[model samples]
Target: MREFKTENIEVAYADNTIIKNLSIKIPIGKITTIIGPNGCGKSTLLKAIGRIMKTKNGAIYLDGKNIYELSSKDFARQLAILPQSPIAPEGLTARELVSYGRYAHQKGFGKPSEKDKEIVKWALEVTNLSELSEISVDNMSGGQRQRVWIAMALAQQTDMILLDEPTTYLDVAYQLEVLELLENLNKEHGCTIVMVLHDINMASRYADYLIALKNGNIVGTGTPKEVITKEMLREVYHIEADIMIEERTKKPTCISYRLNNRKIAVEAGIKKGIKVVG
Candidate 1:
């Protein structure tokens, strides 16, 4: 298993810093998720590790070698990133976009060789986009467009995939399907997956390892059983919640939660003679 590790990386937007001196390990071949409130540096940190954003300080290492030392193409071969908003140019077919994933493997003036065509075909089929391969991106729905982008990422055939809010457009069914696909990739191919998720319950449900961030600092990091708790939720999100262990999935599910009206809730709980975290 290839270890993807980050060490004290700092990222900024001009003079304002978004990701502080943060360091975390993305366990090889496991689904590691970064979860945090809005504007809490989740996306920024993902971009830095993907090399989509420059780190103001520190470095990211893959298998003990600094990622910055590798060539652009070399890095692309091992890691692929699917950003939240990927631009699809006008007149670009779904097939054309997925084929772009092969750019790193191409030598000079890539004209789509037999191997490239096969890889593209596999990517489309895996994403269930074979029927839509020739369709214009403009003609597809938001969910279909998102799947097209994911298909392009899959075509890269990397061991690690970094995604930022990958389930933005999908309904409940598609959302579950996409998450299942990620799990299958990890189980079948030993692919290390890292993503940023806003949904606390979804993060807890799908993530094998969870990294919780609050205001550019790590609130906690552990398995869902250890990380998802009433106190952690209260501390991270300032909410009162009832945590329950699901009998079927054995996942911790937060049922009822209310935002930071801590004193009132605490007082009410005390008056009712019940335990509650303020």
Candidate 2:
């Protein structure tokens, strides 16, 4: 497993900063979820951590060494990233696509070794895609194709894995299946898993730690039981909600009950018993 530390990191595009002096430590061997509203720099921060974005300032350290100093191949060996909305080449079979993950581990003019094949096989099995290994990627459903992409990342066998919105475009059942697979990876192989999640309930249920962001800054960081309070929800998301504890899992579940502006104005009018034409 690997520990990542971002210090005073900043990213900008065309004079508009997307991330500003943000810093956070991704815990090793645990699931860390980054959650925020749309355009809140969640995806930008994930890209910065994976060295996919050009940052204007600050540094990111992986396993106590500067990530920018490593060669591309060496960095790929240590880290693997699955970005949001990845494109796949047409007509590639599931097995063929997963085999590409061994590129970083092979020598000049070398084919996939026994160990590489084993890793790829295990990844396909874990993702429940072993039955479709020979099927073309273009012929699969969206959820099935997503699992294949995740299997490719797992085949890389890196110490750290960064996934941006991994559950996007998936049905409710498939979403839970993917998250369960990730949880199993962390628990069994002790890999560091950092992902950007849109569903707050899933983030709280699956992650060991949570990081809430707003306007490129961190608003809260802690375990779900500690960080997902009513006050933090109101401040970070601008919503009034109640926190409920699940009896089986004992995790905090948020239930938002705030009225919209129009509803609030209507309530006020009713309180005064005034009826007027619009």
Candidate 3:
């Protein structure tokens, strides 16, 4: 597993800086999540960690060595990234797409080795895509296609995997399935996982470490129990809520209260006399 460290990292698009002097460490063999509102640089930070974005400042280190110094093949061999949105090639079977992950491991002038095939098999099996291996990706449902993409990343056999909003198009059941698969990967194979998650409750349930960001800055970093507080929800999400401890698991559960009509009217910039209801 790889331990990732970012120091004074910054990214800008035109005049707006999406990430500013952000430094964070992703602990090895654990699921670390980046949580924030839209356009708060969480995805940018993921791209930087994955080396998909070129940064003008700071450095990202993997296993105590500078990741930028690694060659493309060597880097791909050690790290695999699943971007926020990945499009599948038309008419490509799931197995064929997963086989592309072996590109980094294949030697020049040779076919895929036995070990490569084994890795591909295990990846497909782990993701429960073995049955659909021969199916074309274009015909699959959104959740199935997402699993295929994740299978490709797993087929790479890298110790560190970076995923940006992996559950974007998935239903609730599929979302839990993906998260459980990731948890299994971390627990069974000791893979290091770093992901940008939009759902705070899911992030709290799945991630071992949480990093909250706002306006290109880190607002908090700690375990879910330590970092997810009533104040944090209000500060990061601009919502008022009460935090309670779940009886069974003892995790923090946030309960948001609906604002009264009077407060809602003022917040919505509507006249007091206007009555609106479903």
Candidate 4:
């Protein structure tokens, strides 16, 4: 299995630093979701780990080697990233876009071998996109297009896949569709899936592990039960939440939440002998 970790990495844009001295180790062959409030560096952290953004400090290691030291093709062979709200090139068909995932495995001139074609076909079929293979991505529904992108990542045949907000803008059904597809990948193929998600309940239900972030710092990381608590919700989200164990998933679920009176909550925690961290 490939080992993935970040060691105290700092990421910045121009003069503004977004992530600072953050570190995380992703569990291999499991689905890990990152959740945080807006502008909390969830996307920035994913981009840095996926090598789409350069970290000004520290290093990201994959399989015991620094990622920056690996050849581009070698890195691509091991990992694939699907960014949020990705736009396909105008008029590109689903099959054509998925075929591009084979580029890293191709030789000079990048001609597709028979094996490459086979893998692409398998990806399309696995994503339930075989019927839509010839359809232009621009013409498809949001859910179908998302699956096409996922099929492209699957075509890469990598052990690890990182996604930023894979469910953004999708309706409830489509969101569950994409998440269930990812769950199947992990369970059946042992693909390591890391993604950023906004839906806290969904994250808890679908993720084997959860990383909670706030203001570029990780507030907690562990199984959903360990991390998704009322205390964490208050500290990370500045909101009062009622959490319960979901019967179906046996994971923590936020039943209801409302605006928090930070001072009152902190004082209440103090009175009840609970450590409150913000």
Cα lDDT, all candidates: 0.87, 0.87, 0.85, 0.93
lDDT of 2 by residue, 112-218 (tens): 89999999999899889999999999999877888888889888888888999989998998898889988988898888889999998999999999999988999
Report the number of the highest-lDDT candidate.
4
User: Candidate 1 on 43-157: residue-level lDDT in tens?
Assistant: 9889999998999998899988888899999999899999986779999999999999999999989598899999999989887889999999989877778778877887888
**TM-score, prediction 2:** 0.90
Clashes of 4: 0
- Name every residue pair that clashes in candidate 1: none
TM-score preference between candidates 1 and 4, better one:
4
**Pairs in clash, predicted candidate 3:** none
TM-score of 4: 0.93
Rank order (by TM-score, best first): 4, 2, 1, 3
For model 1 the TM-score comes to: 0.90
lDDT of 4 by residue, 1-278 (tens): 56899999999999899899998999998999999999999999999988999999999999999999999999999999999999999999999999999999999786899999999999999999999999999999989999999999999999999999998899999999999999999998899999999999999999999999988999999999999998898888888888989787789889899877865578679889997888
How close to the true structure is residue 151 of candidate 3, measured as C-alpha lDDT?
85
Model 4 misplacement above 4 A: 263-278
What's each prediction's clash count? 0, 0, 0, 0
Identify the runs in model 1 with alpha carbons over 4 angstroms from their true place: 262-278
TM-score of 3: 0.90
TM-score of each candidate structure, all chains considered together? 0.90, 0.90, 0.90, 0.93
